[model samples]
Target chain A: MRATFMYGAGDVRVEEVPDPTIVQPTDALVRITLACVCGSDLHPYHSMPTGEEGTPMGHEFIGLVEELGSEVTGLKVGDLVISPFAFSDNTCEFCREGFHTACKHGGWYGAGGVGGAQAEMIRVPQASGTLVPIPGDVDEKLLPSLLALSDVYLTGYHAAHMGNVGPGKTVTVIGDGAVGLSAVLASKQMGADKIILMGRHVDRTGLGRRFGATDVVAERGDEGIAKVLELTGGEGSHVVLEAVGHMPAYEQAYGVVRPGGVISRVGVPQYEDAPVGFGSLFGKNVTLNGGPAPVRAYIEAAIPQVLSGEIDPGRVFDSETTLDDVAEAYRLMDSRTALKVLVRP
Target chain B: MRATFMYGAGDVRVEEVPDPTIVQPTDALVRITLACVCGSDLHPYHSMPTGEEGTPMGHEFIGLVEELGSEVTGLKVGDLVISPFAFSDNTCEFCREGFHTACKHGGWYGAGGVGGAQAEMIRVPQASGTLVPIPGDVDEKLLPSLLALSDVYLTGYHAAHMGNVGPGKTVTVIGDGAVGLSAVLASKQMGADKIILMGRHVDRTGLGRRFGATDVVAERGDEGIAKVLELTGGEGSHVVLEAVGHMPAYEQAYGVVRPGGVISRVGVPQYEDAPVGFGSLFGKNVTLNGGPAPVRAYIEAAIPQVLSGEIDPGRVFDSETTLDDVAEAYRLMDSRTALKVLVRP
Candidate 1:
């Protein structure tokens, strides 16, 4: 089975690996149908410490259940399914609260010795809880969008949900990456009156506009904040979504969120410390809430919209490739040549 | 007029100062009926950068309007009122959203040229917005409790409100100070099934119990977290209220909050930065929301309970003194000899 692996920084390869088998009573073997390179993947592709052995890559995929363990319930062999980026027991207190990412027995794909999603076949633990079954055979055209539900779309939805983006809200979305564009779609779906996308790129901002961004600010840093404030009648937006995980993005979010507003981040943060001090947030009465998206929890709520064609988040995939060309997918995404790259297995 | 002034670290004096008078059309001269030394005041009392000019102290008070400026509305001379720690215009976008502390035209007492509450008279700016009028003459016995609403009680309520403490939830309140004790009362009022008060002082914890702390964890830091986790059946509390505004208290809060739970802090955070990295909160899906309490917003909702004797938050005042002995009040509170001190003019 061909799988994607990262040997070191800037080095991605597709190599033949052994097919995954169910090792636990709660596990299932899933045959990958579609996988993609994510914005987060670029973190390691740009600069992750190299090891003697290559690390498995990719955490998002839509697949078919090739085999199910005896304990796996609510699923059958050959059923199309969406696997959340992380595997959870779903019965834990966190999972019950729709925070599957924090499930007591959960772990992320490609971490803790788990099989990666960019592969021919992968073993999924806690299958009953981690896998959301897709009804009927999925159309080839809808694969990329459905596969998005495995992570990015749900993550963007989580950002909007946490930021409290709703009817009549002025929402500012930072980053023009796939997740940011998805957040634009989500803010629109949530009924935000005005959606502002802050990005310097022309192409991505154009797509952001198509995804429901009412305005776009090409300025960065202080200028971006000034632009957002100007667009919001000098009061700043009611909600700010941070889809870029860095100090600058978060600082911009903190600056552009109106007093008493919220800033939600779905981007995996790169910094360790945030200055949530008296000078930054206290006087503003802002609420900061967002971590990993509860992708499993949002799958059901988001799937109908995708299936009904209310939104087409798959447009984020600007390029497509075969399993053997997984390295090209990573290269294209790494260099910003592709907004997102879909890989067929 | 006599007012409490901090000449240096640990040096408090009730000195003769010019009586406050209206300086703005929106100002009102308030004759304080009761003023209390706050836990936050101790921050500067312990050590503040001293100069030739003494710093006026005090931010909590219930008073009678002695004089109303020409522009003052909704308030009349001789009317008793509760003043939030900070004064706001109450018409700004932030105040409209119930965040008066963050009002664009507001500023904290004793900072930014605002009059201190411990004085015989205070010139309150934005009087119509800053003062919540007492319907009738407040009894002398009820003065302390009503004054509690000015800061501590409202602050505790803000913590509980931000933490989303409600029916059937387990609540853990850090600190045994007036605010923490108030949080216990607030949590009970909000219908929390179990309220845990984490404090070391038996006397304060006794007051916490009287205020409705179902459990008391006397341990601090890691042990305190362990005790809270143990009390919640190893799942941690659903809501952790941080009433202590220091690093350890925040760390303990982040430690004991259940996954997907909230940690609401109204402690006037002392630290400049907090580690909100993946290692701290990202994987847990926790939410952090809190700031200076919008006391003006909560006064209406909370005063009814205090007036009806449903809760006695003023019981936190374990000592009383005249304005002349303001230094003694600070001394007693500084050495932990008093839980709280009520000052009368």
Candidate 2:
């Protein structure tokens, strides 16, 4: 099977790899139909050290079941299904609470001897609890949005959900990537009264506004903070969605958040230490939350929106590629030439 | 009039000062009947530099409205009132959201030319919005509980409220101070099923247990974390109420919090930065929140409970001092000889 692999920083490759098998009774083999490059991939792309056999890449994907282990239930061969970025048994205490990302018996794809989703066939452990089979015949038009439910779209939803974004809220979304744009959409769906999208890219911010951003601020750092605050009537935003994991984005979150507001960082933090004392979060009485999306939790509710055409989350995919050209997909996302690059295997 | 002032580290004095009077239309003169030395006072007590006049030394107090400003409605002269640690107009967005600490026109009593509550009389700004009047003649026995609502008790309630403590949840409180014990009491009131009080002092932890702690762990650092994890069946507490502002207290919070849990820090954080990366809060998807208690918000809901004898939060005060003996109150708290010191002016 052909798969994506990273040998080191600035090195992404599509190479032939052995097909995955159902090694555990609760596992099943999945043939990925759709996958994508993520902004998080850029983190490793910028500095991952060279390693033996390289590393499997990609965690988001929609697929068809190719083979099922004897103990696997609620799934059959050839069934179209969606797999969350992280696989969980769905019954663990954490998973039961909708925090599947931190499930006691769950793990992410592409690590710990598991193959990444950007592959021809991948073995899925805890298959019964991990796979959400699409009902009836799947519509081709909903593919992108359904695929999005596996990660990106839900990641954005997680940011808004954790930030307590809802009616009468003034939200500020930092970053113009697919996840950030998705947050703008989610905030709209959640009935936020106003949303300020912050980005330097005019093209992406335009899409952000189209997706429900009431305002756009093409500024960075101090100016961006000032603009957001000014737009929010000098009190700053009720909820600040930090979709860019960089320190600057985090800083902007704190800077533009109203006292008693929330800062939800869905972007994986590239740095560890942050100010939480009087000079930052504590004095303002702000809440800092959001993490790995718990993508599994949002998938069920999002599927109907995609299937019914209530939302078009797949709009984030600005470019497409095949497994054979997966490297180009990474390149497009890395160079910011594409918002998100879809991979069809 | 006499007032308490801190000239420098380890120095406190009760000296003559001009009587307080309303300077603004929103100001009212309050005659201090009850005040207390708070744990936070220790922060400045240990490091505040010597100055010509010195800093006024208290915020919490139950008092009588000696004189009302022309604009101060909802309050009358001779009305018994409770003042939150911070004063706010209670009309700004932040105050409307119950975050009086961050009110746009609000300020603390001991700062900005305002005399502290540890005085014969103190001028309160935003009187109509700052003072919560007792409905009737206050019973002498309920005095302590009413005073507790001014800062300590509500501070604990803020931690529990922000942490989302509720039925069927496990809580871990990391401090044995008045605020921490108040947290234990508050957690129980919120219906937490398992309350783990983590403190080394037997006397204080004993009080915590009496308040509501179902379990007590005296271990500190890794040992404390291990004990808490063991008590939670290895998943850690659902809510970790951090009432000690030091880094170690913060570390213990993360160490003993279950994935997707909340760490509420009412403790005045002494450090400027902390680990917020995958190794700490982010990876586990833990929510970090809490700040100076919006004592004004909870006073209303808590008043009935105190009046009805449902809770006796005032039990936290272990020593008594008069205006002339205020310096000894500071010394007792500084040496940890008193859990909290009550002051009668």
Candidate 3:
């Protein structure tokens, strides 16, 4: 099997790895049909240390069930399915509480001996609870959108959900990355009255506008905060979806959130300390939420939205490649040449 | 009229000051009948820098509307009222959203030239929006509980409300002070299935139990975390009300919160920075919320509860003093000799 691996900083490679077999009665083997590079993967790509044994790279993927686990009752061989980035039993206390990413029996795809999804074939543990099966053969064109449900779209949805985005609320999405754009779309679907996209790239912001951003702020820092404040009549947005996990993004989130509004972050935070004292959240009485998307908890409701043509979250994938060119997929996103890249095996 | 002011850390004095009169068209001169030293007041009592002109000392108070400004239509002379700690127009976007502390025209009482509530006569700005009036003041026995709605009890309610404490949810209240005890009472009123008090003081935790703490842990740091984990089947509490605003209290909040639970802080945060990165909140997917309690928004509902004997939130006031002994009130609360002190003028 060919899997994507990170050798060191800015280096990703498609290398031969042994094929995975169902080791547990609850596990199933999946043949990857579609996988993609994630913004999070760049976290490691930009700074991961060199190693003899490279790190497995991707977490998002859609596939055909190649072999079913004997204990898996909800899925069978040949079914097209989507696997949320984190695999879970989906029956634990956290899972039942709609926090599947925190499920006691769950773990991320690239952790706990689980292979990355950006491979030719991967073994999925807790298959019944982790994989969402599509009834028949999925339309070839629908693969990208279905692949999004596995992580990106749902990750975006989690931001809106966590931020309490709802009817008549104004939302500011800070980032034009795939996840940020998906959040714009998700906010629109959630019936947000207005969405402001804070990103510099006209091209990406254009896509953001199509994703339902009512406005876009090209400036950064105090200027960006000024523009967002202006747009919201100086009160700021009801919710700020912080999709760029940098400190500046977090700062902007607090800078422009209306007092008592929410700042929901899906971007993996690159820093440990943030101001939550009197000068920041405490002074304004704002709420801060968001973490790894409980996409597993959200995927079911999102499936029909994608199927019904209500949202085309796959529009985030601006570039495409084959498994052999997975390294370039990483490069395209890393170099800002692509919003997201779709890789087919 | 005499007023209480802090000359420096631990230096509280009651000095003759000009009697307050209606200064703004929306102001009312409150003949403060009851005022109390709050847990928040201790923040300044401990380390407030010395100054030629000392800072005003109290915020919570109940009084008779001695005089009303021309524009103050909702309150009149001789009317009894309880003023929330912060004065606000209470009709702005934030106030309408039930976050009165962030009202567009709102400001804290001890700020913006408003005299401290611990005085003979204090002028309240935005009177209609800031003071909740009781129809007739008759019972002396219920005065303390009514005084509580001004801040402490409602502040506690804000913690529970912000943390989303509801039926069948387990809650951990992290403080043994007036506000934390109020949180226990508030959590009980909100129907939390189990309430844990993480405080060492026997007398305080005893009050917390009366207020509805099902379990009390005297340990701090890791031992407290272990005990709370054991109490909740190792999943921690669904809601953690952080009534102690120090870093250790904040740390315990994250340490004992269930995955995806809420950590609501109503305490005046003493520090400026905390961890929100992968190591603390992000990995657990926990939600952090709360600021100064929007007591203005909550007082209306609480009035009925106190009036009907549904709750005795006033039990938090363990000490009482007179206007001449205002300095002693601060001393008692500062020295931990009182959970809260009621000062009458």
Best by lDDT: 2
The digit string of per-residue lDDT tens for model 3 on A1-345 reads 899888899878889889999899999999999999999999998998888878888999998899987799888788888999999999999999999989888888877798998889999999999999876555677779999999898999999999999998999999999899999999999999999999998899999999999999999999999999999999988999999999999999999999999999999999999999988998888899899998988888877777777888998999999999999998899899999999998
| DockQ, cand. 1 | 0.77
* Per-model TM-score versus the true fold: 0.98, 0.99, 0.99
For candidate 2, the docking band is high
Q: Categorize the docking of model 3.
A: high
Candidate 3 lDDT score relative to the true structure:
0.91
lDDT of 1 by residue, B1-345 (tens): 998888788888888988988889999999999998999999998778777788889999988899998999999998999999999999987898888887888998887677688889888999999999888655678888899999988899999998889998999999999999999999999999999999999999998998899999999889888999999999998999999889999899989988788888889889868977777776677788888899899898778777888878899899999999888999999999999999998
Error of 1 at B100 (Å): 0.4
Least accurate stretch of 10 residues (summed lDDT) in model 1 chain A? A277-286
lDDT of 2 by residue, B1-345 (tens): 999999998889998988987899999999989999999999989988888878898999999999988888999888999999999999988998989999999999778989898888999999999999999877998898899999999999999999999999999999999999999999999999999999989999999989989999999999999999999999999999999999999999999999999999999999989999888999989999999998988899999999999999999999999989999999999999999999999
Model 3 regions lying over 4 Å from their true place: none
Interface RMSD of each: 1.1, 0.6, 0.7
* Pick by TM-score: 1 or 3, better one: 3
lDDT of 2 by residue, A1-345 (tens): 898899999888888878987788999999888998888989999999988778999988888999999999999999999999899999999999989988877998899999998888888989998999988897897898899898888999999999999999999999999999999999999999999999878889888988999999998999989898889889989999999888989999999999999999999998999988988899999999999989888888888888888888999998999988888888888888999999999
